[model samples]
Target: KVPTWTFHFQRSKRQRDDDALVLPQNQKNPKASRIAYKIEEYNPLLDSSNITPKDWAKIGKDIENNYMDYDGFVILHGTDTMAYTASALSFMCEHLRKPVIITGSQVPIYDVQNDGIENLLVALLIAGTYDIPEVGLYFHDKLYRGNRVTKVDAESFGAFSSPNLAPLVSTGVNITVNWNIVWRDKYQQRFQVSTEMNQNVGLLRLFPGITATTVRAFLQPPIEGVILETYGSGNAPDKDKALLDALKEATDSGVIIVNCTQCLRGTVSLTYATGAALKKAGVLPGADMTPEAALTKLSYVLAKKDLTLEEKKWVLFKNLRGEMTDAAGEPKLCLSDSRFIQAIAKSLSLSCTEELGAVRDALTPSLACAAAKTGDIEALEALKQLGSHLFFGDYDGRTPLHVACCEGNLNAVQYLLSQGATVHAKDRYGATPLSNAVHFRHKEVVELLRETGAHLSRDELDEAGVELCSLAASGDLEGLKLWILAGADLTKPGPDGQNVLQVAQSAGQKEVVATFSSCS
Candidate 1:
């Protein structure tokens, strides 16, 4: 299904050791013959660290020169500084419409147990077949956006991770591509290469007891940009007047200072007084961009000879090339609508369904229960359209509505009730959906059920109390709290004649026991 042309860059540690060229023909296990491709290895391979702005230009030129000839490009690179190269290339190749997969392995290809061959094979397949027209790193069975990846391991095959963004594709028995999250340009643009990256940018990480002299020296002249890796959420020492003055001096002189969080997961927020001080010092928030993306982007923006320093700073905050996420710009969801239909389809493994008949047959009782548990109206509608019985119950006599109430899926309970689902369906334990909702302490679900004239008789209330005691014994603190709020009788004995406190104590649920004691 795919053709391949392999280009080797002579910068990886494995390649430097002269181990990558030793093919399996000379090895004891020659079974590597099954892995086939139309290979074209280029000359003058350079190590990744030796790669610079000029090398990035050369790679971009090569891809642009051959853009019309090949469907995709596969680059074999060293793991060290691979993220840097990936980030740089992502900016250089503008309006890219063909896959540019960068991949490498911890072990050399010469080793029989090496991961190199598989990584190469998968990269080739992804580039050739998939329409992922962007720079990506395919390592260990996961394909990550080039700008979002970081190498976290040195000895294992699964060495790279993308903390902020999810993987573009995951390869296993079936290649699972998460189409929803894949970055796609709204309008097609002409492919062009921009290799002129200014090498004057630098990265400065703040440490404990870091002096102002050190910060000032790092942001000195000729460094047009500096990525200041600040404390959690981009906070630095506000009390350190010397450090603040140094940062102010850098910005006063027109040097762009971008504040990024030193921590891996969160974004930079200027809500804290200390963080707000940094903003006052002319340090722009880098949002949630990784250190790699921040540094490379700074270099790319600074190289724009046509733009002024202020213009470059303005462009840095913009989401160019999908490098940063604007957290405040996300839209709010309305629960009454079909906002969760796609998610329901994904959870039900129905994303690949092409026909309505297929959608109908796939809506098994288990699937219906799953959809109900999540309160997916779109999925339920699809099932109902396919002639699925809305009152369908599982082996335990628990219908879709019953499971929805137990899981506190208020939206699902409301939708099922509107769709004529029986309000008083009982499970094998003689527990109705209302009793289940009460036992679980699902306040929203209980309220919604009660509004629909769903009620529990005295016997049902007694059974629900027993279920609440069992939940207490299992250390379900939230469930116990909810049950109590719903007027569940804590004094009611469980099936074993133990009160809620006694059952919780016997099961070593100390927190539940404490909660029960507090309630009493």
Candidate 2:
């Protein structure tokens, strides 16, 4: 069991054996400064020392009944069953209007160097102040809604993450809230407590040789609901009729069986034969909903008094609290390695400018040129598949060669030069590849461009002044050195009326400033 507030309270009681244990004196509520608040100390469910689960429930009921007496409730519990408790209370507390932030630390609270104090303090602050009515788990300084969370790691300090969902609050020096992502139940405002959970809900994991006997046990008379975790995209063998029949019987008998994926990314649809078989067998596809969300939601719906069985089944598959996404008509973009499959798959490619880049007719020579221009090696490879000759011009009328030189892509510049690119090819502005190479301080590319007999006239030096000064202004020392060595007339003033050295000095390039000092 996880060490909680009771552990600390017990220790305090032991140290001061004579006096009745009292909580730290009341502190001012951080939310509405007018209100003063006191901590409500209670025994945790996992406290084998004195309290049982019933005792803990009684305490929870007391707080839920008399919630107006206090601003919020803070619970410290063992991490093992914290989710169960949080999920139970989410249904038990009906229209909750105040924060009931549950938190636990891996280390004991009494430890001098522990995360407990900070977590407790922050949870208390949020609970006492924020109008968060839903149950939430605060761990490692991040606040996540109780239902959407899973304990991903057991030993790490950062043990929990809401993978399919965004965290409600992220903590640094200040707790930054993603208010747009918070979950609110408009229908749940008028609080109603429903705690009767169908404990017979079966959680079945699909694995190799998962036979009739394995699934048969879960579909037995006792179980009322089932959360079936299926293989990629909710597929099961059509050959398995026994499992199919069992599911069909359960669903026909008013049992709610939800189908979720074992994978972290992607969702299931009733498109394929295998998925359709399960759907026909009365298994509802929980599109993109985590197993935790599905289980609790089923528990919630099963406990509701008003909804009929059909209504409950409909609600299970539909979006509630942003847990599941509505289906899109077209199949989702897949990244599977299967060629025989009719799935849509696209590779991720990033350009040098951090834009998501895509290639049209990816295996074409022209696509290679486009990739070279954007400095995307993957796209370049795809482009090479079509033909040897590849070339693309940017908006500036600069070819792949010009972009390569400017961006210091030595390999791309070399490849372009090797591919019969004219050494003296000038851009729309009449600036050659060597001019860009020198201006960008790509010495190696500049050397190669010069080896290809790249030329720049004395008149071109005047035009080069504007581009060279821009590089210098950005403290590009390498570009400045290349231009100076490549016969760029530093003595010439730029169109901006500032020389390279003046640009460097004004931009705080002390080394470039010193280098240009000698030239001036």
Candidate 3:
């Protein structure tokens, strides 16, 4: 039987003068203020792989119980499932205001040559000193956002890395914290541990010749959700009608199937025909989320008894808890992609310059979109000078203007607008520059797009953002969650001339503010 995990918050304060607080000169941080802490060694402590949601709840509860007393927390966990635990706690701790750093060393703490002590000391320092307000994983001197990390290696000291996002802090001679990416909650919500987790979620990794019976069996009874790991960018066998039918049937029966990529670093955009076919069969894109995050998120989301199946699906689409990146229709590429080889072969085979030019033209839209995303005007200018159409759409029908708005690149957006790029151009989702700006929380981009006469009709969005501020100001928690569930642009200013977050803060509606995370 799995041991029952519990917290023992035995308190003892120590000062710098006391010999009890002694540490090596190199291990200590001179800049950090004096901190007091207590240690608890759990009875029958298990390896990280043995940890469960119950243990996660206990950790979260322990943090919440001592939130006011301590500046931050450091969990000395095992490396095997450190990422999983970190991701779980990130979701479990609602409206956190302090650092919860999890770290472990590949070399055991008892070993003569060990990385454990150094990693532990740094994590403790960071937790006690920095104003990091999110769960983080500290490994090999780097502190990464908890949910974004994965175990990349077992033998190396650098056992973990956040593939899609950068580390929040790094430690050497002087600690460097990436304040720009740190999560700061605007609304001072009451902290709580959400212990409710439904473990009915399943994972189905697709391989060649995966049978229909296997897919159907995996989706059967009591399984509320499934993370369908597919080929590059969420593709599966499109021609296999029986296998497709199994997925279609599961989705049709209200089983939430999220399409995640097998690739370590990439968003699951349904751009290819294979991916589009899955979309048609009702598979939701699990954008840039690791399987561990997706699984835990499913357990957390599906456990919300108040949410309908559709509402759960909506939650999956959102970038909640810093678990995934909202690519916002940006052009994704790799230099080593096979398409470049195909282009070279086609160029060699074709004698016509115009046909070669057609291939060049076809590739330019993606490059232009990429430039717009990066706010690189020089690249955009070069592409334009080469007779590339700045207004052309990429694979998902997103133009350079849309990419600019999504990235909050004000200068790029202005340049595109000035150069006759379509201001009202819509992507495959019927989201224009204005819509992308509002959805992406780009306040300046939203204002500029509106000034350029881009309007959002009622049908364009799941919910009109106008009433969100009013609901927020009134401290209506359900109303706030409803709007969030309906997929309203929470970052957009309401008809009352204030955004929901700002309004919530002004009215001191902490709970209402807690319902939605900060846009960053």
Each candidate's lDDT (Cα)?
Answer: 0.74, 0.63, 0.75
lDDT of 2 by residue, 181-203 (tens): 55444341334455465566767
Where does the lowest 10-residue lDDT sum fall in candidate 1?
Answer: 8-17
Candidate 2: segments with Cα more than 4 A from true spot: 3-36, 43-60, 318-322, 325-520
| TM-scores for every candidate against the unseen true structure | 0.60, 0.54, 0.60
- Ordered from best to worst TM-score, the candidate numbers read 3, 1, 2
For 428-471, candidate 1 gives per-residue lDDT tens digits of 55567877887666788877665554555445655666777778
Question: Cα-based RMSD of the predictions, in order?
Answer: 25.5, 23.2, 16.5
Instruction: Report the C-alpha lDDT of model 3 over 1-520, residue by residue, as the tens digit.
Output: 1122322211122342233242333335343334555565677788777888888887888887766444567788888888888888888887665678888788877899889889877777777655576889889989999999899887889888788888899888888876546654433244578989988888999999889999999999899889999999999999999999999999999899989999999988778999999999999999889888998888899999999888888988887787887665324333223355356646678535565556656788999999999999998987766556687789888999889988999999888876656444656565667767766677777666555544553335424656677788898766555445434577887666778888888999887667675651
- Candidate 2, lDDT over the whole model: 0.63
Q: Cα deviation in Å at residue 85, candidate 1? A: 0.8
The TM-score of candidate 1 is 0.60
- What residue runs in model 3 are displaced by over 4 Å at the alpha carbon? 1-32, 328-520
- The positional error of residue 131 in candidate 3, measured at the CA in angstroms, is 0.6
For model 1, what is the alpha-carbon lDDT of residue 69? Answer: 39
